[model samples]
Target: MKRLADHLQPGARVFVPGLCGEPTLLLRELAQDPERARGVRFVGVQFPGIGSADYLGLHPEAQQTAFFMSPSVRQGLRERRAELLSLDYPGIARHLQQCPPFDLAIGHFSPPDAEGWCSAGVCSDFLPIAWARAKRRVAQLNSSMPRTGSAFRVHLSELDAAIEADIPLTTFSEAAGGSETELRIGRLAAELVRDGDTLQFGIGSVPLALAGSLTSHRRLGLHTGMVSQAARALDEAGALDPDAPITTGVALGNASLYEWAGRHPNIRFADVRSTHDPTGLAALPRFVAINSAVEVDLFGQVNAERNDGALQAGSGGLPVFAQGALRSPGGRLLICMAATAKRGTLSRIVPSLGAQGLCTLPRHMADVFVTEHGVAQVRELGLDDRAEALIAIAAPEHRAGLEEAWRAIRNRL
Candidate 1:
């Protein structure tokens, strides 16, 4: 048992595990004594609850550079103490590997096995690569972290410091079973999935609802970014391959799901490079990628990273996954979202996206669009036809306005 200071020097750039893999002890130490890390810069992605807030709140001088902004980090951004980077999921690994390597990579991990190997557990995102490239590596070996079957294992000999932490691993409840609107969108998206399809499910209620509607499908293979309770259910229903592992980049769920993951031998975790590479995903048979979006315009342009002018999340692996699904034989890319936002006042399906909207997936790459009203298969349609199809799936109240906007654009063209 050693303090983080014993292994880390002050004013260095450190990498902490994002999402559920955050090390409780390490973070608390930083938060409790920010001066210990006064000039240090912390870099990572989404923090579930107390991520960065404690440290940043206490030591505003300690800088933060996030790949994917969390709610807490967003607050820091508002306060002008943090900044977000624009990069794909796989690209995060590449960025960290560049010049002036990270001073220390700190996070949680499973205890060393008899063979002296420690697993990355629920997080396999960029940990392996970060550990390799980092000048120092510190890990909190927690008994509560599920030992997922990830290839990103570091031998005990590689660790600069091993702290035994008995804290509970963070858990997330399954997203509330979708709203009426989400259910409608889910049903339409679920119809696109076929028997023996290799699936990639994204985060958010739309994808969760779609998963809930997929129990009847047979032989679904998972090559996704996040493994949720839906994945566990699919595995139990015999919808997934018993031989081939459900390849994913991260695991996010409650304790029961964690237990299931620990017991299941077919769930394998890989890096973003392997899971999000379009070339690799295209090689899989019958691939189907289901992702959510904030807004999608008549052009089939997808905006998943921002809304109303402010950033919400990152580009993540949407582009690569969409491209991969499109290139796969018998593959389909389904973009699902509610037709309206702001409590039904705003139309998500508009003639053109807002000015701040970043095109995560371009029009030429879109495959299918799903909303509460219906599914729009407009991948090969003309621009006018695409607008018509998209409007058809928009909330009934907004369809007329969207049609008027579309006609105005067509007339000008």
Candidate 2:
């Protein structure tokens, strides 16, 4: 196991942390002199909101190959900062299990209990595959990581090196709900949603805002990657409509979502396979896949990956739904985000994605891009034209700069 330093080299394939399961301390070693680290590619499925700062964003020297698109990695890919490997959840696990062993893998775990077992902590979905195949396994021990029942814990003897840290583990929370901007995005996304449409709900307050307004709707269904309190509120309000089908692969909350699901019949949990089956999603009529983007550009590219070194918000079922939405005769795939973040100082709609923004949603597949200000249909526009329309939707304060930059360009016209 001490061969950890021997097997890795420039451009070596490394499976790094994932899905709120990153090793922040190991990342410090990774950030070592780029000259020595130049050829390493960190690969895994994690989201920006869940990963460490490096995965949220990566050092230029480390190339990346990911299964699910997260914010930080999306930023890098979009900006051509790094290479990306975009695949759905099934595709990710399939690759890990069937593909060649990786040079190294970074893992997280809780301390071994008296039973000589350690839980995969909060993320067990991909750990088993990574633990077995990766040539070298580095464990980052976090006492705070939840010891969930389904996780597969490894013993300390099995770990090659255990780096103990007192850092906070990641968890997703309801966005501070009921903002005027969120309400606006919610209403528009809701309008596109028709009666009896199967839905994919995402994190953030927009879902809550939209959930409240759906009380009058009927036969609506949910089969998503994650669910929040809104799902319960809708069920209790009789808006969930028991006669209809509802399913999910995962549920999350600050304890409220759990309490609501304990005895609920509507909430059925499934593994990644059934949850994100492209075929199953294709069968649903009038499917509406509503997801949020960090910031969308004129071309409708979506980057839902890394913010730090670790990934928090993996694509989960989003790509599968996006493809399925395209197949549905009347289906709609919407990427919704606030026009500005960071207290309105940043414009979510920019002429181009950031230097590190990766394209999670390829421009062609993107149907609608929505901000608090308004929605823009960029489905089939030229690059310049898409830029023009996107700028119009930018926060009122940032539009001028985008336009000036657009105008300065030398076009063939």
Q: Which candidate is the best by TM-score?
A: 1
**CA lDDT of each prediction against the hidden true structure:** 0.79, 0.67
- Model 2 ranges with Cα > 4 A deviation: 1-88, 99-172, 306-316, 380-388, 407-413
Ten residues in a row with the worst lDDT in model 2? 1-10
Candidate with top lDDT is 1
User: Candidate 1 residues 51-96, lDDT tens each?
Assistant: 3334456475777787766675778788877777788876776787
Q: Report the CA-based lDDT of candidate 1 relative to the real structure.
A: 0.79
Model 1 misplaced stretches (Cα beyond 4 Å): 47-55, 78-80
Root-mean-square deviation of candidate 2: 7.8
| Residue 213 alpha-carbon offset, candidate 2, angstroms | 2.5
What is the Å distance of residue 124 in model 1 from its true position? 0.6
